[model samples]
Target: MLWVEKYRPKKLEDVVISKKLLDDILKWAREWDSHRKPLLLAGPPGTGKTSLALALASSLGWGTVELNASDQRSWPVISRIVGEGVFNETLSDEGEFLSSLEGKRKVIILDEVDNLHKKEDAGGEGALLKIIRKKPLQPMILIANDLFALSRDLRNHCKVVNFRRVDYRSIVKVLQRICKLEGIRAEKDALVLIAKNSAGDLRAAINDLQAAAEGKKKLTVEDVATTIRTQQTDIFKVIQKVFKSFDPEVYSMAMLLDETPDNIIWWVSENLPLEYEGDDLLKASLV
Candidate 1:
């Protein structure tokens, strides 16, 4: 099995997230009926939001029915699956009534909810709103990298929680624990190198650690450096070129970017207000 899965946190207590945040999430899950609104967890990839949600379900001892981009996410599919799972609380997925499972609700986890397809998967967002407005029996957790991409109504209806990148130290500690468990003597400096290059992505760090430690009794910085990643132009440089460049042919600078246009738009939009203000901010927003 992949180390990422092997070492995944099985309970909320095992997750390396903030204690206060974990407590709040636990509280929300325990009081879902009164809370009403779904939990909107927005964060960058590999920051453990999905793992935390799954662990939360396990901690609450509630079964889960998850949907992601890989699944057929059309409105009909979502409605059918979610409806069957939540509409009747007395039965299990196997259609057996659990008399002892009173007040227990299945966890509905929708990954990348902000990226719902409006064209091919029409009515997805609308269906979600309808489901929430009706106050379904199950607790829902919506995951996304871009919070603003969600409709204002959807955002208004969720208890939004923003997850920042995990610090390198926290990442290194997790890596150290894995190395100790696998019986591979990984150098502290080597782990540090991997964690730093991971850019606060814990999943990436673990994958790097696994690849670097493969077929080796001891892991070194050189081993990790070779397997990790190559140096690239800083994202800040790309943003600066777009906002501060005097060059008339500014499109040329954008062409030099390694980021896909899909990501570039968000980067520019997210950073525009930070770099521009007053008339400048208004002008940038227009474009």
Candidate 2:
């Protein structure tokens, strides 16, 4: 369990980079109101959008409800819960508290809001548009790799915060700290290589570390070479589809092709313009 969830950031501060953004986030958390529009955290994966949202809820002692795109957002589900209840609600025998009385305001985190591509009875973009406009009881945070993919109407209703890719140096510091905690010895060069190779994704670096650390308690360059396998080229071909193709199926398959999320992103970044330009590129860049 420790190995699997070990890399999950325990606090907002633990998330690499975006310190100023985190400070502003904490301020919004202090007073969560219906007037507070849903905030879209836009950045590359492993940069800590989801982690920061969860950590904020944890620090405030509030309960967090997470929604994913895979879940059915049909009308019955939305009306009975998420829609009728204000960013969704937690029911207790005491009564339905508008905000999670778990000592802090409840936080509703919607992951992959950009996935609102298809039409659904639960109102889809239409329902969300209403929800955001109203500014529900509990605070809501939406995490998306692509902000431009969001519906123009929905985008207009919410506050969008931009998150940049974390620097290699920042990721190295995080890796070093984790090494210290795990009681593992690591050379500076090895750590730097892992950080650089991870392509600014902290999660990938941790995964690499875990894989390398498996054989030996101490990590070195040799371990990294043997443990973390390089991504295949076909992965890049599919990622090219994500930006260049307008077909929905293309987007769906592109995310889960034979490559890891981090590797796929490299292709997406590299070839996004090969298929698109201007606003499309801007929108793709947001994701």
RMSD of each: 6.8, 6.1
Question: In model 1, what is the error at residue 144, expressed in angstroms?
Answer: 0.8
The TM-scores, one per candidate, come to: 0.75, 0.75
Model 2: per-residue Cα lDDT over 1-287, one tens digit each: 44527667777667665667877787677655534777778877767788888888888876776777535544444444456556534543232544344434556688877766445346476667766676676667888877787777777776677787779899889888888888899987888888888777777777777767765668888777655444334465566555556777875776555345546666667776777789977987887
Clash pairs, candidate 2, are 34-135, 75-122, 145-287, 146-287
Model 2: lowest-lDDT 10 consecutive positions: 88-97
Q: Which digits, one per residue and each the tens of the lDDT, describe model 1 over residues 97-190? A: 3443564557778887877644323446766777777776667899998888888888998988888889999999999999999999989999
| Candidate 2: regions farther than 4 A off | 2-4, 73-79, 87-104, 118-120, 230-262, 265-287
Where does the lowest 10-residue lDDT sum fall in candidate 1?
A: 94-103
Query: TM-score of the candidate numbered 2?
Result: 0.75
